[model samples]
Target: MATSGLLNTDILSDEIFDESQARAPAKRCDRHSHKPIDMYCQTHDKVGCSTCMADDHRSCQNTFYIPEFIRNNIYQSVSRKIQTELNKITKTLAEQASKFKQDKQRLLERKAELLADIRRFRQEINDQLDKLEKNSVNEIEDKVKCLESKIDDGLKQIEALEARVTTASNKIAFPNPYQPDVFVNMKMADDAANVANKYMKDTKIKSTVEELDFKHDRTILTQLEQIIALGSLTEDPTKMASSLFRIRGDKSYCVKVKSDTEDCYISSACCLEDGPIILADHNNKKLKQIRGYNYTVTDYYDLPERPWQVCSISKTDVALTLPLQNEVHFISGEEKMKRTNKIKTDFECYGLAYTNNNLYISDASTSVYVYTLSGTKLQHFSETQSGQKLFSNIHSIAVSKDGTRIYVADFYNGLIVLDNNGQVITTSNGKQFCGAKCCYITKAGSVLVSTYGSSVLQFTPDGELIGEVIKADSEGRSESLSVCCNQQMSRMFVCSIDDNIGVYGI
Candidate 1:
């Protein structure tokens, strides 16, 4: 039997992985039954000591000392063979690395070709559309010109007849009694007027050009959007980061809320675009708002029962959840607050969020409830029911800006991402997730979250960990209990159960 240490196993694995790896020849016996391999036991097919011969292989034949056996010029041959193998291995590694580089470069060239093809095809389509637009405009212009020419001809004929009639009238009024041509001229003028009436009748058709105008479909602009996004890129991955949000090693709070007063147990937090943050204080049975610029108590409202979660419905209205009562309350007012309606659910509602007049809520039955403003149940989440490891203990939930995805921060199972219609998109059954608490999605598609007894963290929309958003302070004072960022992602609000709320920039 053979036993291996950590370093020995690593070396063995590397040797097995790269079969070209050559190791130095062993100078001592592997088993170490004796102090040194002084003698070679031929019959036993091993090098052993005097104890082995006395106990087991005493009757073995043709055994010799190692020094005497190697006295016939064998060290030089062994060294040369080992050196040859080392050279071969070095050459093989160099060739393998060169081949990898070549393959990468080849793929890069193919990607460039693909991008060029996309641009070329798009340009061809654009040229065809441009030609169509030019022809349409040209048709309108030509019709306008034809109508203007007909109107101009009618105006010139009327002007000529009016001049002739005026001349004949002047002869009759000024008494050219001696001129016999006056009656003839008057007859000519009358004939010209009759001809003008005929021309007027032919050209009297409506000249309204409004019929030439056409209507356009605005939805075509939406369809003109990218049919597919290019996937391959040589740019650095770090460039994909947002300019407004960042993760740094150093951490500190901009403002601390209720640090000097009694500790406030904040259960939920939500904010609008750079506005004050609304917090649900379950212990105090109130909904409190904290100013973003100056961390002071802006406004608050007393609730009927312990409110578990709170979300902003409009600029001045918010929806609150009461798990003890198994209902949700919708309150609206700016300066004067009032509770307008209450929604009762079958199960206990834990967390509540609003998106596009529709509410997404979490309850006890391993499913999220969707409701309209009038308290109609639209649907429930996911075909796969919530169970032990992955979907267990969903604490907070949020929907994407486009209403395509939903994010739920589970207490035990990290973050679970789902579609808007309640289908699982991603699950964190095996990822490193601390006690995840409140969660929010930024407009830039970043997820900011806080975990119990841990720091706030930022992750990509697809659940790739970006880094820590904020760390616990040096005093080792308290933990992050709730976290929320405004829609603009310009400001963020983080709250702890221990009566401390801090605001930070993106």
Candidate 2:
């Protein structure tokens, strides 16, 4: 026997082994022994050679010769079982592929629709320009025609007067024998001279060198140049049920964020798209990101000045208003926060909110200013359309998910709701929401307002009070200054002017 557990054929005579059999290759067992696989272990559902069966499958009860098992149709049954499972998987994959094809078709159709809309808008603009051009040209032509008509009339009168003067001069120079004819000519010349003098005095023919020049409306070009895009593409809206009914302050966590000199005063809080909670530590002049169930500060970035409010611009980007610096600073990163850009404001920026590439900033006095992300002022909301003062002291602002409504947390006016145009829509004033500090709008359009007093009030998107979600302690010492919720509204975070952050279950 060879070490490979195979019978050595080198020493066998040519007469003992057929030449073809010795030269042919055979399937060997993939095991310790490189012997031909001739056995099947039904108990273990495996195939191996005799040596492997005896060594590894000794305890297996059912075993048979591989050729005998195949002859009994056992291999066909196993093949059928595998084929059935493969068919199921194939069917599932085919269905998924079909769904993807449908989605692709839908996307193509949407692209076509958007393209058509853009073309239609362009056509409308062209039509308007054409109309304006037509009006201006018509006016210019009318003025030109009027001036030509006046000059034509004056020319005819001058021609008639020239004839009269020529006749009068010929009569005097040639010494006409007929006195009446000469006298008539002289009278006609005198009449012509008087008429010409009156026309010269009455008509402004000398000053008729009018210059017609078109002063194009440069404002139109300026506005067109400022437009970044025709519109924004948004995901299809899904129905989100109100989560206010389930909000309960059942949990609280410390956030464990602090500075070297001062304690954390989280004046503002916002949740990232992927679940991280960002906090603006006003006293520490830092921005902190906390994540996980235990709420630990995973990362933080220091600011040059105290941040009054913070708003999420994207999953990895946040904008914070620096009142002292009169700027809104942008910080971005996932693992570590870094200052990326800043927008300088004309007024002190305090309350901040972002939506549709627009920033809504409150001066913390009496007005809220809207600006593009690039710092172009869009609208100013100091008073209502009726000139009534809109806000006294705006602490925070929140925009509805659809970017159609704005909710302002005014310390004096309570909760003030406005349309996207800054027109007042509704206002809610009550003792519970009197000292409103921060406001957050949920995906379902519900409003959560934290007040200077210890209560966090809840209200409908329309500014109707729902009730208080969180209240003060018996001593009325802790005040909820900022409030925010996760994307799903399953978790709510409220922080006071303290180092700890309270987490609530919804």
Measured by TM-score, the strongest candidate is 2
Residue-by-residue lDDT tens digits, candidate 1, 330-419: 876465557889888888898787888898888843778789988899988745655333356777888776677788888887778888
Q: After superposition, how far is residue 116 of candidate 1 from its true place, in Å?
A: 35
TM-score of 1: 0.49
The best candidate by lDDT is: 2
Poorest 10 consecutive residues of model 2 by lDDT? 1-10
Clashing pairs in 2: none
Model 1, position 285: C-alpha lDDT score: 78
The segments of candidate 1 whose C-alpha lies over 4 angstroms from its true place after superposition are 1-244, 247-262, 382-390, 471-477, 487-489
lDDT of 2 by residue, 295-389 (tens): 77878888999999999999879999999999999999565799889999888899999998889999987988889999999988887768888
| Count of backbone clashes, every candidate in sequence | 1, 0
